[model samples]
Target: MQNNRIRLLMLFITLLLPGIAMAASNAKENYGYYCVQCHGMKGNGMGLNIKDMSVQPRDHTDAKAMGARSDDEIFKVIKEGGQSISKSVLMPPWGDTFSDEEIHDLVKYLRSLCNCKLGG
Candidate 1:
């Protein structure tokens, strides 16, 4: 019975791992296509548009800062724009552009970039 359970768990992981990897890849691509203009190619908040912007973009690579923000906050900011959280209005909303799943993927990608988790 235990062996069967183990096999099932292994199979589940095997099936799920690829989807996780694919989500991450798609998130990266989405970021490149949509976010790179302001977030920068390196996720360092040094994008091409910074010179014309009044407020600087958030640095996704800042683990300490990123860790302070919960995943939900990130999702809301991405979907509703930074103004939704009383942050910089310069960050525009992508609610019409990206699906909720894509926004979740983006939150995951940002976490990966910072290598940190909230309240950790």
Candidate 2:
């Protein structure tokens, strides 16, 4: 009985470990569904169609660049579009397309990818 309990605990840890470290939800999928052409899967600003455009997409992993912006700034950019924030106009306003809550989730999801916070 004691051995069985220990084995079950080990199994539980094995199963639960992956879930605890699971990456944030759907950011990859969202990139595929919407941002792949310009932002790229890695957010390196080197997406497939980026070369033909006048302005390059923001590099999500560029800690130095993204660090200066605040959550509100990022939020506004995502909701109202980048042009409103003086970024490339290619970033279309998602304000009409998704709810405020959805936009918040997107912001969190993006932050996760960059391993960056708005101020960090």
Candidate 3:
């Protein structure tokens, strides 16, 4: 009976491991919570705050431009804010708010949105 219970528990964990991992991935949730408002959910640069800003956010869907930029540049922008690269002061840094892993995953999400690889 004890061995059967342990086996059942192990099977349950194996089946749920993927779901648990996916939940922990948290890229979509993080992006939606932190970036969608400012960068737009579709990544078209027309976010909620665009109307109140001088410079528009870079559209992640802009394949041409986004492809031109390196991932490191994107990472830097996220880490240092727009002002670091003279983009916009309104774009505050999220480096302090997020982990490096989160930022990297966000970058991958941006790439997926654009449908273009870096420097492509």
Candidate 4:
């Protein structure tokens, strides 16, 4: 019975790993498509649009800054625009463009970019 449980657990992990990898890949792709223009390819906030913009984009790679924000705050800003978080108006609302799951994925992606978490 223990061996059977181990086999089941292994099977579960094998199936789940691919989905997790896919989610990460999709998040990266989404970032490239929707965020790279302003956040930069490296998430350093040095996109081409900066030259014409008044306010600078937040650097996703800034571990200190990103770590200060909670996951919910990130999701709200991404979904409802920066104004929702009392930030720049230039950050447009993407609620219409992405579903809640996609936004959650994006939050995770942002966390990965910063390589930090709240209070860390």
**Strongest candidate by lDDT:** 1
- Can you write out model 3's per-residue Cα lDDT over 1-120, one digit (the tens) per residue? 999999999999999998756644676788788887878988888789888887888898999999998899888899889888878887789999988988888788788889999887
Q: Can you tell me which runs of candidate 4 are displaced by over 4 Å?
A: 1-3
State the C-alpha lDDT per candidate.
Answer: 0.95, 0.76, 0.85, 0.94
TM-score of each prediction: 0.86, 0.72, 0.78, 0.92
Best by TM-score: 4
RMSD (Cα, Å) for all candidates, in order, is 2.2, 4.6, 4.5, 1.3
Model 2, C-alpha of 2: deviation from truth (Å): 24
lDDT of 1 by residue, 33-94 (tens): 98988989999999999999999899999999999999999999999998999999999999
Evaluated at residue 111, the lDDT of candidate 3 is 89
Stretches of model 1 off by over 4 angstroms after superposition = 1-14
Residue pairs in candidate 3 whose N, alpha carbon or C atoms collide under 3 angstroms: none
Q: Ranking by lDDT, best first?
A: 1, 4, 3, 2
In candidate 4, how many Å is residue 96 off? Answer: 1.4
Residues 2-76, candidate 2: write the lDDT tens digits. Answer: 999999999999998875444335445555677768888777788998879998888877776777777787789
